[model samples]
Target: MRLKRKVAMALTSVVAIGALSACGSTPSKTPAASGPKKLQIFSWWTGVASSKALNSLIGVFNKKYPGIKVINEAVAGGAGSNAKAVLASRMEANNPPGTFQVHAGGGTLLSWINAGYMAPLNSLYKQQGWYQDFPKSLLKMLTVKGNIYAVPVDMQRSNVLWYNPAIFKKYNLTPPTTFSQFFADAKVLKAHNITPLAVANHGNWETTLLYSDVLLGTLGPTQYENLLTGKAGTSWTSPGVVQATKTFLKMMQYANTDYSALHWQQADQMVAQGKAAMNVMGDWAQGYFTTALNLKPGTGFGWAATPGSQGTFAMVSDVFGLPAKLSNKTATKDFLKVLGSKAGQDTFNPLKGTFSPRLDANTSLYDAYSRSAMASFKKDQLVLVIGQGAANPGFTQAFENDMVTLLSSKNATAFTTAVESAAQSNPL
Candidate 1:
């Protein structure tokens, strides 16, 4: 077996190193192996919760493939920007990891799939008979030209409005279900010297995440989808776009001071600590509440879909893809098997604070918030996170820059015009 040979070579190398150590000589720092024997999986999940979730799956993966060492090559940064930059460098030099993480939908990273840098996993999906296991709609998102490029690990709902229950009850304020209601509550919260909304523009992507929810809440799902796919002339100068911009500005007026100084997690922590009334962010904040903050889900916090977006689920699926022409194909494929399994989903999703993409995953393993999320997923129209998921990366970046400028400018018309220009200049 290949594993047996690898073990033999390692033992011999260790003995040789021991012999050199006895001579007061330096031993080689390189791992002595016949060939590639480790599976390096790179991702932005260097944070506590996401890392724990990935590690839980690794625990299962080790049971399945004990011979292969799973290396956790995590790069820490918000939006995976730091990791994305590093990945681009590695991929440019044809030195990619065994596998890397990406989103499952829209124009995000479509170039890599189209460029043939990713191996088509269609055969693997067929071998596992997964055609019916995953939802057809989800498969549609991951597939291009009849090939599935990656395996989705979990589904995260992005448009959730998280709030402090104790704070809301203390102020006799119910969670807002519409923008009008949100503004009304903002007034009351402001009167009490409490920050109404918590937003962190530390990175462009977090602010984009916040604004995308407002875009969805304003334009609704169908129009939003049109904008992503560049249908219906899809210019950002549209009336709906203007309305969304205005709405975003209005919300910004209530946000915490020096918001750009905090990261997204710190904004969520404000809600968890009852220092702020609410935070409109993705469900990862739940993982922060439970895993890091050691707080109960429904008891410690409250959640609803972002105002006026009740029937839509703004989603981001964290997916993994094998590098092109992998040296350790067998190990990477075996890891992919774990990524797509119900058992793997069960172990990973609960800890990750996201729901399993698999319909058959054991829901019992998820928390109360996740169970509700899972239920809503089936009912809500699945809208992609435009800034991070649906739109082209270049366009998304430009849009983020426009949005950040708009935060200070408060010039909705110029913002919309700049966004329209960005949309026209970039390819979908």
Candidate 2:
């Protein structure tokens, strides 16, 4: 199904206001009712690690507001494709949940804001002193026309390369930091009858995600951002895009033959079981490794920035916003208060395998991998992840479709042409 197409249709009004800056009036607050209420929290976080993290956050909310009942409306599959479809239906029917998880960016959250489906949280942010808590860059992402629409809970680094330490050591190999070194390592691994890279395209967005990293690694962060933002000198068919696409196609040669059939978690499992030497995925794989596979960090697995992407952090954040016209507005605000709290973020992000977007979160609660990521998030150049929340839904949909075709055709020229056309139609 064309999931992003549905999203684009639902949020068609976003295009008109896409270029507007973050400036707007503050919304008035709604006082809490004195009786018990039920709040439905919606998301696509049914996986073992994500589900556990959600439960922990809900448990905190429950303890604080015992009079409110939280209903988890989590739908599984497609890395939120299924959940987005369900959410769109509920929103259209005016059966919006109390609050729902959304990615923090113009392409995702701004669509909901511009469509008038979300409530501005400026008053809430002021009440909670969140302006100082979250980083300026993060809050900026959730803002449009001076109104902040969502509260980001966690920060995940998308440009991560996870490798099996045992497999690397057995081959006397280390993580590669450049494409030349990556191919060299792949050659060695392949000679030993090992899959060099573990990949999964079940959701059709994984390869697109990989290509985003390849773009950043190839063009550097500035040019990559320029291309996405439709800068004057940058174009989708530029030499950098061509090189990145070629690199992406070459990397696929080292991936598993069954990549089309496996889920993302299954691809992570390939590295866990030593069937594959490496996988390039978001740091969420850290949660699956530690929580589901019972593997320890540092020794069990090693991680690095995707080849040539060092000193840059590609981020995908999961945020929640107060939907407009909710009966449990007070309860939802209460939940948002907790969600954006330092205590709540510290409780949730440790188990979720991500860093809290709040700058002052307790670092001791996180693991070695997460602590490292947190450090990078603070000092490195940050970029939004494509196919997650960086680009508009129309472009994201076209990009995913093009990646799927490139998998079979391996036609780099055709890939660039299609993507350039998508950029023109979608306007970034």
Candidate 3:
């Protein structure tokens, strides 16, 4: 389905920037004002709870680094789809924000790294001693070759299934652990006039997220990771992926009719308000539920890995990377140091519903869902979430378009062909 809000705005400046940069001349921004200037930070976490969580962290940052004004310029849309386009326009104009959100994985990072628009944060890592603080596995995703390029803000588990516990109790149901169990429960819920799945077809990124869970559940860990990273040469066209697409199609059948018209949060609200039983969304929904809606973790809401994805953690990191064209590198780097610190992440992640990317973050500050995610992060088979992982951004768009096509037609053969072709055309 096509997105409701304009998701992909045509960034003509990107094309112009490409042409101009090829000619060895790119526009230079007029330098920052003579006095202390505002460190304009760009991001997409503009929702009520996420905004409060970030603003709280900004409060702390201001206390630590006085005389610097921290301006949060967030343009909201799922997975930074809208913000990324806006960011590309600004960066290409050589009017980069001091720092902006980017997926820590190659899916979002490789293009920026390859374009040489990012600064190498290796020296910052060494200077701040962050190598010992963050998880090495996550660091690996954030790294290109031997250099780390971003300061990770938080970690989100993409395959989490958030459901209304009261709705489950009323339906005499427990969280399903497999697809068959899920379908069995879905039939009962549907008969009882409850929408079994909460999904948003108004946006493609959320659809990609929803399908990615079903994809992970069907393909399992090793093959799923391989396929996402382009390590599995033959699996792209395999029956396994087609089966996953089929499962995704079946899951879509039980969704609300207005699912196509609703945004991801509206779809999620169907579950939260007891109009639906479950939602296939990321753990960021946790923040919305707990902080915004004031729902408790174990009592009001519950979380489980998407069916058949137990022992696997499909995740993405929200990170801030420095642009090479910043007019305020000094203030930006100082803020980055705050982002990398334990105090900073601890203050942010609890309310944001993400765990700290750092191994040493205080777990006592985390709730039940976050604590469980942290444990799974350590022991589970971790895979970079394909929607936000290491693939080219164009490839992500192609994948999302194909996913929407597959959902509508339910043609496994065509879906596989389209995805395989997209991957071939846009390799990481």
RMSD value for candidate 3: 9.0
Give per-residue CA lDDT, model 2, range 306-376, as digits (tens): 99999999999999999986755788999999999988998988877788988898999988999999999
Q: Which stretches of candidate 2 lie over 4 Å from their true place?
A: 1-35
lDDT for every model? 0.85, 0.88, 0.83
Q: Estimate each model's TM-score.
A: 0.88, 0.88, 0.87
Query: Cα lDDT for residue 66, model 1?
Result: 89
Best by lDDT: 2
What's the count of clashing pairs in each model shown? 0, 5, 4
Q: Write the residue-wise lDDT of candidate 3 on 67-145 in tens digits.
A: 8999999998755778988988987888888898888787767788889899989999998899987778778888888
Q: Mind giving the per-residue lDDT tens digits that candidate 1 earns over 1-428?
A: 99999999999999999987876633222344665478899999986668998999999999988888999999997568789899987787667788988987865557688767888888899998778788777787788888888898999999999999988888898999889999999999999988899988787677788888998899989998888778867788889999999999999999997888988889988888877889988888888888778888777989999998998988889888877756557789999999999889888888777889887878788789999998888777887886657877888889889888898999999999998888889866
Q: What is the lDDT of residue 156 in candidate 2?
A: 93
Question: Which portions of model 3 show Cα errors greater than 4 Å?
Answer: 1-28, 77-79
